[model samples]
Target: ENEVVASMSANVFKVQVAVGDKVIAGQSLIVLEAMKMEIPIESPRDAEVAEILTQKGATVSTGDVLVRLK
Candidate 1:
């Protein structure tokens, strides 16, 4: 299992993957807006998305778990 985490404090701008979705390494899973910049949180490895812990427009802090994969 793998957990994709937020790298910085930001608002979730978009969620690009859903539960059970297949994802590859480097695929964008979520978009976050912080300090007027958009950051794409990507998959670290190929896997099926198991859960999404955040929602669009939600505020998240650094190291927050965003997605879980299996």
Candidate 2:
């Protein structure tokens, strides 16, 4: 299993995938807003999304787990 984590402190702007969704490397899994800019958090490898740890509008700090995949 692999996890997608927040790279910086930010508010989750959007969630593009859900649990059980099939995903590929580089696909956007979540969007975060930091410093007034939108950042896309992407999948690291091909996998099925196993969990979403954050929701839209949630605040997250660096290294916080956002999504889990398997």
Name the regions of candidate 2 deviating beyond 4 angstroms.
none
Instruction: For candidate 1, give the lDDT.
Output: 0.97
Clashes of each: 0, 0
Instruction: Give the alpha carbon lDDT tens digit for every residue of 27-51 in model 1.
Output: 9999999989999999999999999
Which 10 consecutive residues of model 2 have the lowest summed lDDT?
A: 1-10
Provide the overall lDDT of each model, using Cα atoms, as 2-decimal numbers. 0.97, 0.96
Over the stretch 1-70, how does candidate 2's per-residue lDDT look in tens digits? 4988999999999999989999999999999999999999999999999999999999999999999999
Give the TM-score (vs. native) of candidate 1: 0.97
Alpha-carbon RMSD to native, per candidate: 0.8, 0.8
Predicted structure 2, TM vs. truth: 0.97
